[model samples]
Target chain A: AQTVTQSQPEMSVQEAETVTLSCTYDTSESNYYLFWYKQPPSRQMILVIRQEAYKQQNATENRFSVNFQKAAKSFSLKISDSQLGDTAMYFCALRTRRSGSARQLTFGSGTQLTVLP
Target chain B: SAVISQKPSRDICQRGTSLTIQCQVDSQVTMMFWYRQQPGQSLTLIATANQGSEATYESGFVIDKFPISRPNLTFSTLTVSNMSPEDSSIYLCSVALGGTSTDTQYFGPGTRLTVL
Candidate 1:
């Protein structure tokens, strides 16, 4: 069994500033994937960024990036140059592809982010 | 990235009734999944709809409760049977466009079901 934890229940960031959302997971599997998903007010789940456990380098997608520390079992998301549109509920998810097991995602409770102007 | 749409974006139904939500993807996908997001909670995978086979459900979920239909690679439906207030949640449909195990998945807008 795997579990993802987002310690922060809510976060706020001023416009044009940067914000970091923390995430940690527990998994025995060596090969896995970590993802950050954003659900806006419209209720649309959007993929923010993803990190492969095997990759030592962090994953960056424009303003969204991940600080993945495999040894510490930590994967945090950083949103740079934050805008009002970045306000959303962010969730961290983990997925492992172990043999004979279905590919499913285990998500954290989520952190509601508010970008204040 | 694939375009996924779910019909009946939001619905308010009475308890004991049922609601069937349809998911359609613009392109054929390798895998389709259903998830539930309760209020103020994160997403929990309900089942994986496999084409030409029975849908595989996760722990605490059953076929009778969430009957899923995956007729093809691009279309699927999930019916909430004998709904209750506890069933009030956002149901999302997602798809994996690639065959790799680590491929990214695209999500639909989600169908909001309110059981009153």
Candidate 2:
């Protein structure tokens, strides 16, 4: 079984500031993927960014980047120059391939991010 | 990326009734999934709907309680049977394009169900 953990229950950052949300997971599989999904008040779940365990190079998507530590089983999301729109519930998820098919994602509790202007 | 939409964005049903939520994808997808999100809680995958086969349910979930149907490559439905207050949660439908290990699952807007 794979379990994702988001230590922070809630986080806040001032506009134009930076904030990092921590995530850790336990997985025995060598080939897996990590992801961050954001859900706004509209109840829409949007993919934020993804990091492949085999890739040592961190994944960057504009202002959103992930610090993926495979050995440590830690994948964190960092938001730079945060804006008010960043306020949402962020969830960390893990996906591993098993029996020739990718399994469903196991998500953490989530961190509520509030960006203050 | 895939554009997925769920029908009956929201509905309030009686405890003994059942509600079937429809999911439609703009393009053909290899895999579809159903998830439940309780109030202020994380999303839990209810089952994996695969075309041409039966849906695979996760632990603590059964086919009778939450029956699923995958009629085609771009459509699926999830029914919450014998609804109760505990079943009052958001039901989300997601689709995976390419069906690869690295492919991301795109989510629909989600259907909010309130059972009384």
- Write one digit per residue (lDDT tens) for candidate 1, span A27-53: 999999899999999999999988889
Could you estimate the TM-score for every candidate? 0.97, 0.97
Q: Pairing residues by index, what is the TM-score of model 1?
A: 0.97
In terms of docking quality, model 1 is medium
Tell me the DockQ of each model, to 2 decimals.
0.77, 0.75
Q: How much native contact recovery, as a fraction, does model 1 achieve?
A: 0.87
Model 2 lDDT tens row, A1-117? 789999999999999999999999998899888899999999899999988888999999999999999889999999999999999999999988553344789999999999999
lDDT for residue B102 in candidate 2, whole number 0-100: 66
The alpha-carbon RMSD values of the candidates against the true structure, listed in the order shown, are 1.1, 1.1
Candidate number achieving the greatest lDDT relative to the actual structure: 2
Candidate 1's C-alpha runs over 4 A off are none
What's the TM-score of chain B for every model shown? Answer: 0.97, 0.97
